[model samples]
Target chain A: MKGTLIKTVLIGISLGLIWYTNSHLDIYNLSIVNNIGIFAILALSYNLINGVAGQFSLEPNGFVAIGAYMTAIFIIPMDTKIDMYALMDPAPVILQMQANFPIALLAGGLTSALMAFLLSVPVFRVRGDYLAIVTLGFGFIIRIFAMNSPAYTNGAMGLNDIPEFADFRWIGSITIFTFMVMIHVIYSKYGRAMKAIRDDEDAAVAMGVNTFKVKTYAFMTSAFFEGIGGGLLASFLSTIAPDQFTFLLTFYLLIIIVLGGLGSMTGTLVSAIVIGFGLEWLRFLDDNMNIFGYETGAHPGMRMVVFSILLIITMLFARRGLFGDRELSDILKSKRASKRKDA
Target chain B: MSKGILKIENITMQFGGVTAIDNLSFEVQKKEIYGLIGPNGAGKTTIFNIITGNYHPTKGEIIFGDETITGTKPNLVVQKGIARTFQNIRLFKSMSVLDNILIGFHNQSHYSYLEAIFRLPRYFGQEKKIKAEAMAILDEFDLTSFADHKATDLSYGNQRKVEIARAVATNPSLLLLDEPAAGMNPSETEDLSTIIHKIKQDFDLTILLIEHDMKFVNNMCDLVTVLDYGEKIFDGKPADAIVNEKVITAYLGDFTHA
Candidate 1:
């Protein structure tokens, strides 16, 4: 009873904090906060497959692309879509696509979920490194499809003038929802089955886990939220192109989850914030600067270089990432126990 | 005589060019503790795999409780009232002992993923019920004290007990144990034998076990089947197996008068 009260109070406090930040922060800082929220959603969902279910899949970029395109097509007005399709006339299906913001977001999620379901039949046929290779190809295939389909997607040029429906309110709420759902799953029976599959697939099969079904379920769930995250990204930026949903986006999320701790959701949350801010803060490295007395020209991708070095240092010092699969709550409980022992 | 609870009919398992089990046949009566013993590479574990649906037999069928279950998936085999343990202890290393056992009740917890994610009433109700049942199984195995400990952190004997408890939590009518006494000391082995007997009686289980311990076989099994080169060399009383001419020759090899 006391534990439940404490949790309820904590949740209330956090929600209040989100509301405060939404109302008080300026557009620049608020955009960073919204980006972090999207980051949290994407990383949390990705970890379900890569970390929790223990399937090394590299297909989030594909699913996110699908989500972004679907949501963009649905949310854009019929006239705007036709005007935006500069390469060729808009496809009849693309012109007919229309939905409210919530419906558009849901459509994005469902389409990606459907894609994930179809992909699993072939993707799950391989395991370990082969799974990674097959999924990486899947991401590539999605990008190529986007690039080739001009009538629907505008080909090389991407959709623009997307309505800014995904504000801090939307992103923040969804991020918390995603976090809560993940926690619920990690503590549920299906979650146990997932961990069982992660530990040893053969043993899980013997335990009647239906390894394929559990894995597919995890994959679809991961895709659904990743799609939504992509939708939020599209609306937040008010533009999206095939190029934006590349392996680089997936690579950033991979770095976040790895730096957070693979299987720990709390770790993912903390790492998302740290990496989100860290990336922006490191932008100074990309500008022209003087080292001592020598002036060097700006390096466009220098931020990534410094980021990689920091990751290497983190790997050397904390090989399992920030939390090493232990959640924040578990650490707190241990700390409390030690304090009591000291007393 | 009790009717057969499990029938293995002429099951042949072939992998590429190698034949693992050739025309193996066995029938385990209801509530009987049956033993499958053989030398290393003699297809004992292969037979267990075939029965548990890990390997579909290249040729034959498996019948459990009057249902033809050959070539079924491993999860379906467990759903059809068959559960098994591995030759090596394969507990989930990251999970607590309670969580490991709760996984055995995976099929039993009749709540949807939505309910679980949303924490609906059904989720809480089923989870509470299942956790209690898992704890009870642990209590029966005297593992309640280690319920929250990491399953791999348990002692070897306790780990074996936990595995058996997990298998029993699946509510299986037929239990397949692969080398349950593999690495136990004599006292641990004795305790294991006692616990196995108790569970067989308590759960009303028909057990088919693969073991190298002849004493364990004599003490626990009602009947023994001996295999040599994937062929049944002897099948009868455990006491009779030791004295059979073919069994002795199979174990010690044919002696030449010099």
Candidate 2:
């Protein structure tokens, strides 16, 4: 009952935040708000696998791509199906089918999860950097499949004309839903078992934890949310291509989680928002570096250089990331206890 | 004529060309505190490996409670009422003491992942039950105060205690303590002996212990066996095993030649 109450209140607050931002902010800022919602889902899901589960996965981009393409296929308007497939032939069933935005988004997420399930069977045999290697390979494979499977994915031309059915409200609701489920799972016995596996696999196994099963479950679930996040991005951007879901995109998520402090949920939220906006706002650096209105000339990758410098500074100073495996609620709880003692 | 709860029948564990445990055999009776002792690399741990399903013996079988358990997985072994601590401490370093213990009850947990994710009534109900039960176990081990502390943050003695507490929380009928008193001070070892005795009686558990702490082994174990070079050198009463020439020579090299 308490969990449900807290969840409803959070959803209400998120909805209000989205509505307020939409009405009050300028177009550019509103778009940032949308990016924030999408990034929250992506980063939080990634955190479940990397931070909380301690799996060190680097394949969220592939999962996200699966979701984006699947969702784009469903949400593509009926009239554009022939034109969309003109570059390559879509399946006969795909041409005849049309799903609502919500169903399409759900299918997109499930597709990513399905792929994760298959990938996990082999990947679970390896741990540490080996797991990362296999997962990275999995991501590359997905992207390559998207590139070559022109009959389905339109090759490199990518999917356009995707319906923008989801707005700020939809994103907010999904974010809240995703956050609530992940939080509950984190606090449960299932989550504890995952953490135990993370801390020491042998110990966890001796303690009766099915480490392989738990690891696979965590990876698959994380992939599910990554897919949803990518689906949302597709609708928000009204376009997506194979190039958009690269290893660099995975690196961007890693930065968010690292800056947020790996296992901390609120930290992920804060860092995702901070970095998401920072990425867009820093585009001025790429356009033409200006300090006191002195142009240093345009450099296409200058923004990335500055971003890399900031990440280096963060690593040098705050190696454990912002919250260092702790959440804001932990600090609040301590403060409340201290105040009570003083009183 | 009395039977044993566990029977290791001609178990030979060979790794590559080297036979770690060469045709070893032993039996542990129900509710008996049995001790296995040896010098380093005598295949005492190798015997443990065979029992814990870390190795499928090259030949022979392990019969526990009338069931053959020669090649079970570690997780399944725990579910079959067998739990063990490591020779080296292996607590989940990043988790709280409570979580470390709570996870030991993974096989006992009734709620599904779906229920846990949704926080359904069954989830909260099981969580509360497990929490209360874990707290009770912590209190018994004098670990309740450190329940919220990380497993690695505890003192060395407390970490060992936490590992044992976590193992016991699995509700095993047979508990294996692999060098449980390895790094403890005298007082800690003294306390551990008492804890082992108390748990054996209170939980109706049979214990198989591997310890170099002779005093602790003599005090707590009902039967003691000595192993040297992968072969059972002595098996009898603790007093008899301790006084046996082979057991003595195994620990201290023979001076008769010199």
Candidate 3:
């Protein structure tokens, strides 16, 4: 209990720092911090399926893209919109409502969730690598469909001039809210069913778990949050494009979950924040660093090569990842006891 | 007239060219311990699997509580008040013991997705009540002490107890336990017998168990059915079934004197 209190205090302090930084910091720093908050939400939301539910999914980027386009359609100013690739006879009636940030985010999430429900009927029966391939195909299909559907998504040129409504405070608060709700669900009875399915599907079925239903619930819920994260990203950047939500984004999210540890919520949270900031921090070295007298800037893909190598090493050495399914509370408890002994 | 809880009529399960269970018929009366004993590969487990909806019998009709539940999904069968444990311990290894039992309470739960997501007052109320019930069930098996521990971290005996406790948490009218005492020591087997008796009396459960432990089966089961090569050799009182020459030969060799 004492350890929990301390951890809560620490989280409060960190959140306070983020709030202060967002309000008082310079524009560039604020933007970087806002991006971090957006990715953090994306990572944590993806963790619901990939981590806590013990399912490998590559569809977060697809859901996020859907959210982004939905948000762009809803939140962008109608008067300022230019006809870059004007496929619509006129803008749809729902897009003219001028919704606020929260409503747009919700719309994005719900839309993505609906898509997930439609897709999961056939996809949930397949397990492991097959499931991953199916989801990856779904993500590609979403991107390709967005590119081809000139009427709805503006085709190849993509939608632009989306209104920027998500500031640092908004994204940060939503991220924290998402984290709290996810943690609660993870500890709840339904969460137990998800873990049971993850651990042993056949055993769970024998125990009377409606495996398909539970899996569908998890997939849709996770997709909803991922969509919201995507909406935030589109709003934050003031743009929506098919290229932004690609297989690379899915790969990065997978790295975040694996680095955090499969089924570890706290691990996902920590890894997201750390890797979000780490990716930004490494940008400084991209232009200047040289390895074995070879200019790194000459090879633009070197960064991802290094990143992929790091992931492979992490997998080989620490197959369970950072926390190995231990929650933050468990880690804090041991730390507190060790601290007391040292003192 | 009190109807039999489960009526298996001419259930035959075929795997490729081999028949695992050939025209097997049985009935489990309510509130009784039905023992199924057979030599290895006699298709005892296959019969259990067929009844539990794990496998669709090539040909058969299974009537549970007057409903034709033949080839129904396992989860639906469980919701119809039939629960089972595996021959091997199949507890959710990563989940806490309490959580493992709580999974059994999934179909019984009334909370909706919204309630669970938002942690509404009704959700909390149901959660608290279920936690208490799970603890009570665990207490019966002396497993309350390990409630917070992962199911896999427990000893083999404790894991077996956890599996049984989880099965009971489903509140099934008919509980099928496959080799519940497969790996227990003598003392553990005795304890399991007592636990099984207490559970049957407390929950009003009709149990059907496939057990190799003759002593445990003899002590707990009132009636026994013997099987040899997917065929029933005897079905009668435990004493009568044990004394049958075919059953003795199936267990040991064909000994003229013994």
DockQ of each: 0.85, 0.86, 0.77
Candidate with top lDDT is: 1
TM-score, one value per model: 0.96, 0.96, 0.92
- In candidate 3, the residue pairs with backbone N, CA or C atoms under 3 Å apart (3 or more residues apart, or in different chains) clash, namely A51-A263
What is candidate 3's lDDT per residue for A159-185, written digit by digit as tens? 888777888878888888788778777
Worst 10 residues of 3 chain A by lDDT: A88-97
Judge candidate 2 at residue A40 and give its lDDT. 89
* Candidate 1 CAPRI assessment class: high
- Candidate 3: stretches off by over 4 Å: A1-18, A86-98, A125-130, A289-299, A333-343, B1-3, B251-258
Which ranges in model 2 have alpha carbons more than 4 Å from their true place? A1-7, A126-128, A289-294, A334-343, B1-3
lDDT of 3 at B27: 84
TM-score of chain B of 2: 0.97
TM-score comparison, 1 vs 3, better candidate: 1
Model 2: lDDT to the true structure = 0.87
**Better-scoring candidate (lDDT), 1 or 3:** 1
First chain TM-score for all predictions: 0.95, 0.93, 0.88
